[model samples]
Target: MIMSHPDSIPLNQVLPIFLQVLPLKEDYEESTAVYGCICNLVLSSNSHILSFVPQLVSVFAQVAVSPVESHEVKVHIGRAFSHLISIYGHQIQPLLGNLSPAHANALAAIAP
Candidate 1:
């Protein structure tokens, strides 16, 4: 059996940190940076991100649609969503139906 790289932390470990931090209202800057990092990680190692796709999509959608979030954060979320779709278009299809209207709209704005 082929082993994944030792330096690549398991999704189980990395996801919890994202789940904890992404929803906080008090740290927009930190959360946005974390969101960008997560997107980059997903782009670089999509297989590792597969199990957490639903949560990842939802968190980004939420951020993208949030009126209180800064424009910069929303733009980052939109870019992240675009990157994800470019890499994993089919994988994200089923989850799109489950998104809230605002989330769907946000995604639609960037859809190809």
Candidate 2:
């Protein structure tokens, strides 16, 4: 429902809350749901989220290297990364480099 009307939503307030979900690692369903929302939000034509891409990349790196995360969740994250790369192209490469080798490789491997 939120993704369906991404343009109307205030990204700044909601996105941070969603970003918190991955680190907490308390609820699998919640984590996956957050990833799903992210995947949808990235694909949506909401330019506002572009400002949050760095933050999103940081969190995605965290998730990519998270030992306990499910493959399904990583798949969702991969799709989000792919969408970001499609939109931002080379701009994303630098951020990926700042990550740990394994994390960077994991994310790179996931994206096209």
Candidate 3:
């Protein structure tokens, strides 16, 4: 229901695109397309995507730690994390308490 807003559409669509990239190791072109979309989501307005932060970080963390994920995908996730930290870290920190202190501390440091 909350995702029905026009402003949220771009952010809402990012997860599926990221999924497409995460599972496809051999398709550089396709992966790049999805990663670009994810980058857009990262930079999108937090008010539009505030509810989706946990989903975004969980997916990115899953991919970030996955050996099966492509290096390119991992790189996108890293960038996404940076964007999330810089843009929405305060909003996302509670959801990320499951992560180690060092990583959580780093994210907290980057958060507004």
Question: Model 2, range 1-112, lDDT digits (tens) per residue?
Answer: 5667775777778777766664546676577767777777777746666678887888887888888878888888888888888889899988988888988887877665
Off by over 4 Å in 1: 1-11, 110-112
Candidate 3 lDDT over 1-112, as tens digits, reads: 2223446456446644545445345655565556555545566644544456676666566555545556766666677677777766477767788776555554444333
Per-residue lDDT over 1-112 for candidate 1, one digit per residue giving the tens place of the 0 to 100 score: 0123424666667666657666557766676566666766665655666567788788877776777777766666677677777877887888888997788888667444
Colliding residue pairs in candidate 1: none
Which residues of candidate 3, in runs, are more than 4 Å off?
Answer: 1-30, 99-112
Model 2 weakest lDDT span, ten residues long: 20-29
The better candidate by lDDT, 1 or 2, is: 2
What TM-score does candidate 1 reach? 0.73
Strongest candidate by TM-score: 2
Off by over 4 Å in 2: 20-22
TM-score of each: 0.73, 0.83, 0.55
